[model samples]
Target chain A: MFETLSNVFTDNPLIVSFAIIGITMYIAYKLSDKLTRGRIHGSAIAIILGLVLAYLGGVLTGGEKGLSDISIFAGIGLMGGGMLRDFAIVATAFGASFDEIKKAGMSGVSALFIGVLLSYVVGVAVALSFGYTDAVSLTTIGGGTATYIVGPVTGAAIGASSEVITISIAAGLVKSILTMIGTPFVAKYIGLNNPRSAMVYGGLMGTTSGVAGGLAATDPKLVPYGAVTATFYTGLGCLMVPSVLFLMTRAIFG
Target chain B: MVIFGVALLAICMLIGIFFGEILGLFLGVEANVGGVGIAMIMLVLIVDYLKKRGKLSLPAQDGLGFWSAMYIPIVIAMSANQNVAGALDGGPLAIMAGVAAALIGWLFVPLLSKGGLQTEETVEENTFIGGENKNVRNIK
Candidate 1:
C-alpha cells in the first residue's frame, strides 16, 4: 500500500515510521491496560480520521502541477488538524449537557476553560523561549489542547522561527511530561476545585467527549464533524480563486 | 500513522518553504500555517458529515486522529532537519530540546497557577489526632 513511500525514505522511511508508531502505540496501549485496571482508552475514531486525511492529501497534492494548483490547499488540511481537534474540544465543552460534562470530568465550562488557559500560556511561553514563534502546529489539540484551540497556523505564527516548525511541538512535549513528572501540579490544577477539571482520554476521549456532549444535548453526532468540514473549506480560502486563474493561463498558452 | 503524518508534513513544509514565501507575499496572507489549520478542520467536518449522511467521506479525514499523534515525532525530527539526519542523528537533540521545554512548563505552570488552592472545593482539616480533627485550623 505504501510502496511509493518506501522509495522516499531510507528503504521507505515514511511507511516504516507509520508502522513503528502504530505498533508502539498498540503495545503501549496494551501494556498500559495490563499495568492498570480497565481504564485503558481505545482510539477508533481518531485512527479513522488520521488515515482519511493521509490518503486524500497524498492523492490531491500529487496531481497538482502549476503554482495555481487547487491541491495546495489540500496539503494545508494535513498540518491543521490541531486546530480542528480543538474545535472538537470546544464543541464538546459547550454542546455537552451538565450531566455529560460532569461525566467527562468537567463540573462546568470553567474547568475546561482552566485546562485551555494553562495550555495556551504554556504553548506561548515555550515558543518565545525557543525563538520558534512561527513554527507551531496543533493537529491533536485536546489532551494538551493549547495550539489546537488557537488553531495550528495561529500557534505556528505565535511560535514559528527560522529555526523550527513545531512550536506546539514544544507545547506537546511539556504536556506529556506534566502528566507524569508534574503530576502533583497537574493534579492540583486539573483536579482542584473540581476533580473533573479535565479529562485526559486522548483522541478517543476527544471523540467520546464530543459524542457524549452532543448526545446529552440531543444534537446530531455529525456536528463535531461539521467543524472539520468548515475548517477545511476555510483553509482553502486563498487557494480556490488562484488555481483557476493559473489553470486558465496554462490552457490558453499551451 | 505518525510516519505518514510526518512524511506528509515534511513534504508540505519543504514545498511550502520553497513557495510559501512567494505565495505569502503575493497573496497578502500570513504564512501558509493558517491554511493548514483551516484545512484540518474542514477535512474532519467533511468526513464526519458525509459518513453519517450516507455520502462519501473524504479519504483524508478518515482515521486522522491516529496519525495526529505522530505529530510529536515529526516535531522532534523536523527540529533537527537542518542538522541533517544520518544514522543516530536527531535522537539526543530532540530529547534535549523536549526536556528543556518541559522544565520550563513544569517550573512556570505552578507560578502561573498561583494560589490555586484558594479554589479548593472543600476546606482543609487543621488537625487529625485526638479531638483535634478540626476542619478549620486556628492559629493564635
Candidate 2:
C-alpha cells in the first residue's frame, strides 16, 4: 500500500494531490475537536497540494524530456512541497504556537545580523592589509549557510552578496541557525526548563526540523503551503509535516 | 519577518539543490518544497499580516482559529488550479518574481502593523498543543 501510494504520487503527483485534497477536505469536515482539526486540515492541504504539483510536473517529467520539460513545474513542485509543509505546521500551530515560534524565530534574525557583521569586519581588516578594495564579497562568500538562509534581502540590504551564490548561502545558513536556535527556545519555553530536560524537547524539535527541512527542501508541490507557514503563521504543523511524511511513507508503502 | 522568510526560501532552495536530493533519498520520502512559496507569500502579504498579532506573548488559544484563516486562501487557490504552480504563475507577475517582492514587504510590514491601534487587547491563550486541547478532535 505504501509503496503503491508513493509510486502513484511519484508517478503522478498532481493526481495524488487532488486525491489527497479530496480526502483531506472530507477529513477536515468530519474532524471533531479543534486540535485534531488543525492537524488533519493542515497536513491535508500540504499532502494534497504536493500531489497536485508533482502530478502536473509529472506531465513534464514523465514525458520524453524528463526534468527540463518539467523543470518549471519541477521547480514549482519542489518548492511547493516545502511551502505546504510549513503552512501545515504554522496553521496547525495556529495563534498560540505561532507566536511562540515567532518569538523564537527572531534568534535567526540575530544570528543573521551577527554573521554578516563579523564576516565583513574580518573581511575588511584582511583586505586593507592585502591592499585590495573589492572586499565586499567578504560578506558574499563569507555569508555561508546562515546568510543564505536569511536570503539576499539582508545580503543585498547590507550589500553582503549581490551575486546569487553568496546571497543563497547567507540565507540558508541563517535559517539553519534559526532552526537550531528555535529548538532550545521551544524546549525552555514549552515547560522543560531544565537544560537536560529541555535538550530532550530541543533535540526532538531540532531533529524534526532537520527531517522537515529536508522533505520541504526537496518537494516543490508543497512549496505553497511552506510559503504559508514561513510567511505568516505558527509552525504547529512543523512536527506534523515530518510525521505525516513518515505516515505517508508508511501508508503508501506498508 | 517577511525578510527572514525570503532568506529562508533562498537558503532552502540552495539546500534543496545540494543536500535535498541526498536527504530525500535516504529518507525514502519526497523532501521537495523547502519554503520558497511561503517566502513568496510573505513577500506578498508582509510578515505583520502573515502572523497573528502578538500581544502579551503569554500564549494564544486561537491556534485552531489561525489554521482556519490560513486554510481558506490556500484551499481555494489549490482547487482553482489543477497545478499549483500554474495557478500561482497565472496570478500577478509580482508573485512569479518571488524574492524581489518579499523585499518590498519586509521594508514596509512594520508600517502596516503599526497603522492599527498600538495597545493590544488581552485574548485567551492556548499554552499546550494536544496537552491542553485534548478536547479538540480532527475535522474528519
Cα RMSD of predicted structure 1: 18.1
lDDT (Cα atoms) of all candidates against the true structure? 0.29, 0.31
In lDDT terms, how accurate is model 2?
A: 0.31
Error of 2 at A223 (Å): 17
lDDT string for model 1 (B1-140, tens) is 33442333334334433453455556554434223323333333443454457554233222233333233222211111111111012133233433443344334433333343343232122111111112111110
Off by over 4 Å in 2: A1-15, A18-89, A95-133, A149-151, A154-254, B1-140
Q: What is the DockQ of candidate 1?
A: 0.05
Report DockQ per prediction, comma-separated: 0.05, 0.06
In CAPRI terms, model 2 is classed as incorrect
lDDT of 1 by residue, A21-105 (tens): 3554455346546664423222222222232333343344432111112232322332223333333322221111222222433
Q: Roughly what TM-score does model 2 have, to 2 decimal places? A: 0.30
lDDT of 2 by residue, A89-187 (tens): 343322223333333344333322332333323322332333324433333222222122223332343354344333334233323323322322232
